[model samples]
Target: MSAAFAHGLIVGKFYPPHAGHHHLIDTAAARCARVSVVVTASTAESIPLALRAAWLREAHPQAEVTIAPVVDDVEIDYADPEIWSAHVTVFRHALALAHGGAPEIDAVFSSEEYGPELAHRFGAAHVGVDPDRGRFPVSGTMVRRDPASCWRWLSPAVRGHLARRVAVVGAESSGTTTLARDLAAHYAARGGPWAATRWVPEYGRTYCEEKLALARRRAKATGLPKPWLDDLEWESPEFATIAERQLLWEDAAARTGSPLLVCDTDALSTSLWHERYLGVASAVHPRARHDLWIHTSVEDVPFEQDGWRDGEAVRHRMDARFREELALRGLPHLVVSGPPHARLERAVEAVDALITQGWAFAAPL
Candidate 1:
């Protein structure tokens, strides 16, 4: 008999040992006498095998866990037994240690696709613990590449590390401005610090104007080809600045300690417009990163102009483009339904929905 197996072995990367991971280990240990956790990072980037081992060990001190480093031979074919066999030897050794590492182990627990395979290869009963059923596959690549934008997907420990506190964004005339004011007012009334506005239209104009002035100055100074380069680059400095401000709001949110750091508009609009106007579709962009997007429709509300405004034909076209933008960016946004006032209510509800969806909050900090 397989030593009357009762304890299990669990294996994973354990990148920050999030709750989901801790859950797997805990649940596995319950079923088995002891669950040996193997934190695998055969060729991890920068994060050393030793450090990864330490983190796993520290996180699950009570559990009978053994951390092992498996080195796969890269010189041969990716799927060759030569490569896998060597790694399997390391795995087998890890299992052997787990049997007597601290407590009695008898089973194998896994929440990944290859966990069962590993279990079968190692001669352990496989127990699947993924109750979430892949609803939200929060990948390491997405979190590392754009933490601010993808912060909601992170574990609480990682999310807390983010500098910017809160962000609100949405489609054009989507009540982003109204919603921002309402949210700030709500937060302020609740005895919290005030939030920062994303666009602050005046700032946008001023920023763009400054960029234009600089371009004028640069054109005068070096004379870098008029319409071709000078005006083209100078025309949308503000747009680029706003794009960078997307990242800035996070910092501004951190400093404020407010319940919500609302942005009237974010980089998505700026980037889209920059592409449309400045021919910067290929050039450098500031790149904004607002958290929540509220979609506003001007179906009933007249597309009124405040001088710095574009027409419905443009807004309509932009609206269609905005959907594409959201899809491309993997952002979750709520539509502010109804006429003017209805938009306001819908925006409030939509934001409230987003909060519920992400489990993100800091007790007004």
Candidate 2:
């Protein structure tokens, strides 16, 4: 069968692209030989224009995607003739850039009422996809108002916009890793308010392991004394680097927009480690305020001997340091102690209380 239109145009704010927007684009792509998706972002939009445009390009590779920036100072009133004319001019320029010329647009695709006027401006047919919205049963407004409730509708890129972070911290062998993983799994299974959850493992441990291995190899090659794990230095600069890298990893995980991000040993833990090992305070602290902080207790869990782990005495000292630092900083946190299962339950309870207390999901600034 022949395509109904030679070229079609789909335009929207796409503040955060959702499934319904995908349906409209996909429908247009199927019926048109060529499709151009214009993502117009105003300065007032919380999400960046480039990010939204990138989502459209990834979502519908078959369509040509472009971003149009609306100046922050301009008052947007589509009904006004002056405003409509200005937008039309911008759309024309964007479309021309996409096609490399003044390509003919035969159809205008949308799920909005303005499709007719837009189509008329281009002298094209208006093809409204799911105007009644019964098929997708979702809208940008609905998704924005309550992202957790509308998690199913959002794309991963947009999910990052609404995700709340939870950090799990404590001394070595304090069940921080296990509790973090369990908290993520618990949220994933529950599947509401936050449709999904992600966990970030301790990056410092991995970094130390890699560096120690390299140091040991160099010692053997040069016939120098074998480097002992105890000789590993924890300087203020190293702690600052670890904290920065940990935050980067957490932010990368957040891009998927999982309702919750469970991080094992965030930058705050690094600060405690720096103070304990080198007796120097961290120059850079974890600046991002997590929605919830779960401090695992070093008491019940037996300290496991690892290549890099300090002894039981060190664990006890570090645990005390964590408590002191947390208190001194006045950061609210829940201390979870006991066996793994019991600790998991307490952490879950704390998160539930937060949700019940109407914890707002404030995306990282």
Candidate 3:
């Protein structure tokens, strides 16, 4: 079997790529040997054009398609030929850049009434895929209004961008990991989209374990005495590395997780940890944002050294520092103390309130 068309074209704002847009792109890819997906956004739109292009590329990695982005802030006026020409100019340039020059487009795929006009401008045939929106029943307009309602219709990349993130930060053995895991489980037990809920473990612990193991291996090779876990040294750059890796893992989880993502620790927490070990403030900064922060209190919690803990005294100082930094930054957070179950209960309530409040998106153009 051979593809019916040599080349196909798709152009849209793709404010936030949804399932419907993917279907249209898939439809074109099945019929054409090559497809060019042009993502055009106005300057007034909130979502970046580069981000839209990246999402499309991620969503259609296996498809034979080129995702191109171009910015156009021209006023729309369907009834005026001059405005239509201006819009076509932008589309043509996008396609040309994707191909290094304009390729003969044999088909234009869309789910809108303007499909025919778009194809005619490119001297190609119009292929409409579910123009009535009967299949996916979703739109950029609907998603922008309340993304949570249309959570199922979004791609993982888009979901990652919209998902609400909760970071649990605290001293060692303060039950941060326990609380994060419990919160994720509470949401996953819902058995719908929530079934995919995910929790990101603290990356710093893993980094430290690996660092200590490497040093021990080197010492053994040279006949030096095995160094204790607490003997591992910390460098300023290492904190930045840990923070960067933490965000990478968190982002990966958010992409596949439910609308609510729980992280055991975040980059902001790394900054505090740096100060605890180095006795000075760190230059490390967080690249990502957390919607809610849950500080696990060391009070009433017995500090159990898992071979990596810095003991009860250090734990208390770290816990106090965490609280102080959270307050100084004016970040939204709450402290959870007492037994594991009690801490879990309070964390769950805070998460419930966050989800219930809903997301507030900037108005789209």
Q: When superposed on Cα atoms, how far off is each prediction in RMSD?
A: 13.4, 4.4, 2.2
Best by lDDT: 3
**Candidate 3 lDDT over residue span 287-362, tens digit each:** 7669999999998888798888889888898898999989999999999988888888888899989988877755
Residue-level lDDT tens digits of model 1 in 88-174? 566666655645444433466777666666666666567778744464455444444444444444443343233332334434454
- What ordering of candidates by TM-score runs from best to worst? 3, 2, 1
Off by over 4 Å in 2: 1-7, 29-36, 42-45, 57-63, 71-105, 191-196, 233-258, 275-289, 299-304, 324-332, 338-342, 356-365
Question: Which of the two candidates, 1 or 2, achieves a greater lDDT against the reference?
Answer: 2
Q: Model 2, range 1-365, lDDT digits (tens) per residue?
A: 88888888888877678999999988888898878887776665667778778777777766343433332323567689887787877787777776677778899998999999999988999998999999888887777666667777877666665677788999888888889988898888876655557899999988898878888899899998888888666567877888889988887888774777889987778877787777777778767747778889997898898767888998898888888877887776888898898999899888877666543422311
Clashes of each: 13, 2, 0
lDDT agreement of model 1 with the native: 0.54
Listed in order, each prediction's TM-score against the native is 0.44, 0.77, 0.92
Alpha-carbon deviation at 166 in model 3, angstroms: 0.6
* Rank ordering of all candidates by lDDT, starting from the highest: 3, 2, 1
- Model 2, residue pairs in steric clash: 159-257, 160-257
